[model samples]
Target: MTVLLVDAANVVGSRPDGWWRDRAGATTRLLVRLAQLPERRLSGPDGGVVVCDGVVAVVEGKARDVPAPDGVRVERAGGSGDDALAACAARLAQEGTPLLVVTADRGLRARLPAGAAVAGPGWLLAALDETGCVPPA
Candidate 1:
């Protein structure tokens, strides 16, 4: 079973579609989209199937209140989003669980636990589109 750790702020802010203007609203929309990930068959960077048993979206600042959905958990980062995500990855990795970190931030990617796969925002967006679980408008 694979567990996904998402940098919610990074993914939500990847596009310039006014996310900065309303961070909470944007994060809420992103959380709704993430709720559909579990049932969808997503493709990994290696062209293999990416199946997630659990999805954790780490948010900070104004976007910390997005509620969790089935198979998903909304985590509020006490400090930095990167640190929170990295910590989650480390904890999961220590348990020998397969992990995937979703974000396009290079620095964040570098900070993830070893053996964790990294996927960018575009990858997630494409998968969501393929599964017909498009992001809320």
Candidate 2:
């Protein structure tokens, strides 16, 4: 299955829509977008997990255990989310799961495996459109 590891902070900071001004607003928007993720067509399993610095406890679009109606999962990171993600990616890669790391941080990118796919926020937004990750409002 494709396990999408999302970097919440990086994504929020990547947009120039003034999301940084309001962390909650940015997080809500991102979660909504994540909830709209689409089914994978890559000839294998696919899923997405959003790593946030803090936990929201409950999210409007959350779908419990199962993948979101679309194909994403939202999660909160403990103290070191990025480190955890990199480590998870490495382990998942070893197990043969397609790991797509979404982040704009150059430093974090260096830690991913050499062959892992990395995309910035702009790229992710475009992908959302391409994958129809979000349904029509």
Candidate 3:
């Protein structure tokens, strides 16, 4: 199964939707949108197809309190969200699960385990738009 790990802060921040005003609200909206998505078969940046089987969002700071929707799992970071994401990625990689991390942070991208596929927030946002999962901006 291909697991998609989302950097909630990064993805939410990618869009200048005024997420900074209310981090928790923005996170909740993002999670709700994610829950509404049907199983997706997306084109990877490397010209391959990526089938997203499961989704996990790592939340931190003010957004940590946002509850997860039915189809999404929320991981609250006690401190650094990037650290939490890296740990999750490492664990998933060790289990031999195909992993895809969604984020635009170069440092976090560098920290991900080997064999883990990485996609930027633009990729995710475009997919959401294609599926009509995002609200009108």
Candidate 4:
């Protein structure tokens, strides 16, 4: 089973799609999109099928209060979202779980444990689109 760790703030901030107006709403939208994804498979970076068994979205700042959908777990960060993500990644790595981290932050990417697959928010949005999880424009 592969666990997907999302940096909610980074992903929500990527498109500049009026997310600045309401961060929590944007985060909620993202989580709803993620929850809509098919449970069995997603397109991998290498063009193969990646099984996503779990999803964890780390939310910070004003977005921390946003509720998560059924298939997605929302982690409200007490401080830095990046720090919470890194810590979760580290714990998952220690448990020998395959991890896919979705974020565009360079520093946060560097902080992730080795062997974890990293993808930018663009990739995530593309996947969501491919899966017909389109959000409102």
Candidate 5:
């Protein structure tokens, strides 16, 4: 089984898609895309989790609520979003589960456990496209 930990903020902020000006829109698109991941069969065996640095909800400070796909969970970064992701990957590695971390940040990529697969924003965009999450031209 393979576990995927996503740096949702990085994925949302990656491309020159005007995400900064439309953070909510970008996040929606990213979340929608993430929701499609398993249906597209792109997620590995263990499933995926989308982690962000901000609060998960509009009213809740401790947790924000985001729509998670059938096999995905949306989580706030809390202490350290990236740190949590890295730790998840490390735990998976210890369990002999293949780990895949989705993000374009070079530093975060470097911190991943050995044997974890790395994919950048471009790759995620492509995957989303494959799943028909990216709007049609």
Candidate 6:
């Protein structure tokens, strides 16, 4: 299965879109977008494969309790989001699943398994927008 790991704080904070005021709200919005990602299909030469089988949103601080949508899992980081992300990635990698980690933090990227696919926040945001799943303001 294709596992998509999202750094909730990093993705939400990627743009200066006033997410800091209500972190939980922003995280909820991101979860909505992430839920849509797995349903997205690329056409034509891309062969119409689904983007992901599941999405894991690693949330911390004020965003920990955001409800997850179907096909999405929320990982509450009682401490560091980066640490939680690393742990999640490691677990999935050990299971031999294809891992795609969404984050812009270099340090977090360094912690992922060697074969984990890494993409920046803008990449995910653009894909969400393309699928008409823009995050709420």
Candidates ranked, most accurate by TM-score first: 4, 3, 1, 6, 5, 2
| Candidate 6 lDDT tens digits, 1-113 | 46778999999999998998999998898898788767555221223343567788899999998888886889999999999999999998998987778899999999899
- Top TM-score model: 4
Worst 10 residues of 4 by lDDT: 37-46
Query: For model 4, how does the per-residue alpha-carbon lDDT over 48-93 read when each residue is reduced to its tens digit?
Result: 7778888989999999888778899888899999899999999989
Task: Please report how far candidate 3 places residue 17 from its true position, in Å.
Answer: 1.5
Model 6 pairs whose backbones collide? none
Work out the TM-score per prediction. 0.92, 0.66, 0.92, 0.94, 0.69, 0.89
**lDDT of all predictions, in order shown?**
0.82, 0.58, 0.86, 0.87, 0.58, 0.82
Tell me model 5's lDDT, rounded to 2 decimals. Answer: 0.58
lDDT of candidate 3?
0.86
The digit string of per-residue lDDT tens for model 2 on 32-96 reads 67665534442111234433221111222122222222334555444565776677667767988
* Cα lDDT tens digits for candidate 1, 1-137: 67778898888888899988999988888788888877556777679998767788999988877676676787799888888888888988998888888899999888887768888888877777777876666
User: Backbone clashes per model, in order?
Assistant: 0, 4, 0, 0, 3, 0
Between candidates 2 and 5, the lDDT winner:
5
Model 5 CA deviation exceeding 4 Å by range = 39-69, 134-137
Location of the lowest summed lDDT over 10 successive residues in candidate 6 = 42-51
List residue ranges in candidate 6 displaced over 4 A: 42-50
Model 1 ranges with Cα > 4 A deviation:
none
Per-prediction CA RMSD (Å): 1.4, 7.9, 1.8, 1.5, 7.0, 2.9
**How many pairs in model 3 have backbone atoms within 3 A of each other, for residues 3 or more apart or on separate chains, i.e. clashes?**
0
Candidate 4 yields a Cα-based lDDT of: 0.87
| Root-mean-square deviation of Cα positions for candidate 3 versus the true structure, in angstroms | 1.8
